[model samples]
Target chain A: MPSRSLWVPFELGRPLGVPDDADFQIGVLKSLLGLFNRKSGPVIEDYPIESPVTAETDAAWSCTIPLPPLPDTTTPAEALKQALLQEVGSLAPWHAESMRRMGRTSFGLSGLTPESMPEVAAFLADVASGENPEPLSGLSEPLPIAIRYMADDAKAYYMEAANEQPGSDSPGGTRMWTWIYHETRMGQVFYDLRDRLASEYADRMAANGGERPPGPPPINPISARFAVRPEPTAP
Target chain B: MVRLKDLPKEYAEGLLNLPIPDYGPAPWTDAPDLKDARVAIISTAGIHRASDEKFAGGAADYRLIPGDLDFAELTMSHVSVNFDRSGFQQDPNLVFPLERLRELEASGEIGSVARWHYSFMGATDPSRMDETAPRVAKLLKEDGVNAVILIPV
Candidate 1:
């Protein structure tokens, strides 16, 4: 518990409500700073405005970039790898445009550049297929950690490019997330990796008497959960 | 929206059932007026400079973000993928609000922006932060930060 806290009923990632709205953000700051005048203890105030993007649903939004058809391969993982690499290649120009305009991106969480995004996808595909490939670019983190970063970096790369397209900003991140998981081959790749990690995690748990073993298990199940968002069920 | 009724049933239940840490009695201090207060932002959004170490699962450490650091240089390596990163990707202000604070300073709403801000990855057990909290408080005091806004995402 904080001595003074202002609770805003915004979406999970957005604390100040909407992005790119200066007046609203300033208003939030004023509300928070105004708490100082109360001279009271442990004040937990609720912010009074509902974010415009709250529970925002964008059913009409879709990525404009068309991906090349997936190549047929004997191995399913290889097909995923090829398709993901092509997907990244197709989005490169738009991502570059977004970079030119924004001057920076959140795409390098895995220590790999946006140009190296295809490699990150390939790494995950390999892991998904049950091969323990050496860490790319000599990253010293364990396989689970590397997998988590690569997965995040993959989605980040795609979202940055999508943001460059028209109508990308309408409903905010949730819409983009819906598009990523429901429409793209990259989304399929995420599901495959999650399934692979889940198997490994179950084995670890079973060996440890149905409880997680201490100090970083061989596979972190959380990574698998983070890698994919399941399609929303019908009410 | 964060109202329990608005969230998915499982997630809302998880949050409701979470064990609230007992931090003993809440400490109280009267803050300086908004115009006289030097404010620092403390976010649990797992954001930091691109060069900083990534937060592993349940890691308790925090990162220092210089107020003047370029927004593009900031990145998030928070361990959870459950939250939306799209907002932060589109605008850093939604998470950090440094720009908003700067506007307030220019308008004379607050005394000043602290030269440094801090971020810690959320989802870490708060009890694990016991050792580091005091040190952060000391640093805030040294920088004349009489008020801090703890933003959770």
Candidate 2:
């Protein structure tokens, strides 16, 4: 078993679901719920791809997704659509509004109209909302590039931390709650389709279903390292 | 785990004098006389614009991607953070902490600022950084940066 808690499904930085998208945001929480069920029982979930490789002409964007090979299920086009659907299924209608609000509060923004777009949202629509559900293992080409990038980081950081200094031992190795928070604080990026990035988090308890203390809404911070660098290591 | 007061007093003094073009104090202490340290930043702002690609895989373990768009304006669209601008105009901590790093470089706390930095949208898988960090390491190496700070957005 990997010696760490797994948390992926919120915003790009804080993978616990953004506060705004109340309904769909729960997907992040649900995902966490799923994580708890993995009792050394190989828990492997697949993510659908978002964005079309052919549409990806810009080298910068192209580099980010690293378009993968066509899935065996169908044509590359079908694979692309399947990828987009899963993303859309996990999203909320207010995704844009929430993102805008988030951008305003955290990133800075101009407005939510058509003209002020920083980047084209449609391109993502194709990829994120597509429905080709396949294990990340099947992806090759562009996407594997991105996935391998993240997996390698997680593995290395843990190894590096082990070498640096031993961490505090909460009951079961790293507490699920603390581990989740620590990883997010360490700068864990969630797997796709926007609305899941929320910083407010609490260790999931059998009684508390995992909700942070409520109140005080001043742009919740998610692991300061992400706020500035990677969240301070739990060592 | 550095206490606030314990932090170099120069940093606070500098933060106060920012937007003035010349912040007098150093950015970080504890850092060895950083003549050429490499610095990198990680953003949880989930910032990749519609222009950038979202994360891939079961980060069901890490929440990320297929972000919605707010076509309204581009004030801070350049950045992907979800911060409020009420306090950030004169100081732009929202995007990447360019101003802050610049202040450090100006004060000589850092030998020199790396020309380029990394911007991870923050919601994807942190486990998969093996793929991301190297890209940054490569970029930094190409630019001749020695150490990386990794400013979180």
C-alpha local distance difference test of each model: 0.80, 0.32
True contacts kept of 2: 0.02
Instruction: Give, for candidate 2 chain B, the lowest lDDT window spanning 10 residues.
Output: B58-67
**Residue ranges of candidate 1 with Cα displaced over 4 Å:** A54-57, A138-142, A168-170, A204-235
Q: Chain A TM-score for model 2, please?
A: 0.19
Candidate 1 lDDT over residue span A193-223, tens digit each: 6677778878878899999856564433223
Q: What is candidate 1's lDDT per residue for B1-153, written digit by digit as tens?
A: 378876667778889898878877755677898999999999999999988887877888899999888998999988776868888988899999999999889999899999999999888988999998899999999999998998888
| Runs off by more than 4 Å, candidate 2 | A1-235, B1-32, B48-91
Best by lDDT: 1
> Against the correct fold, how does model 1 do in TM-score?
0.90
Each model's TM-score for chain A is 0.81, 0.19
List per-candidate RMSD values in Å: 3.3, 23.6
The B-chain TM-score of model 1 reads 0.97
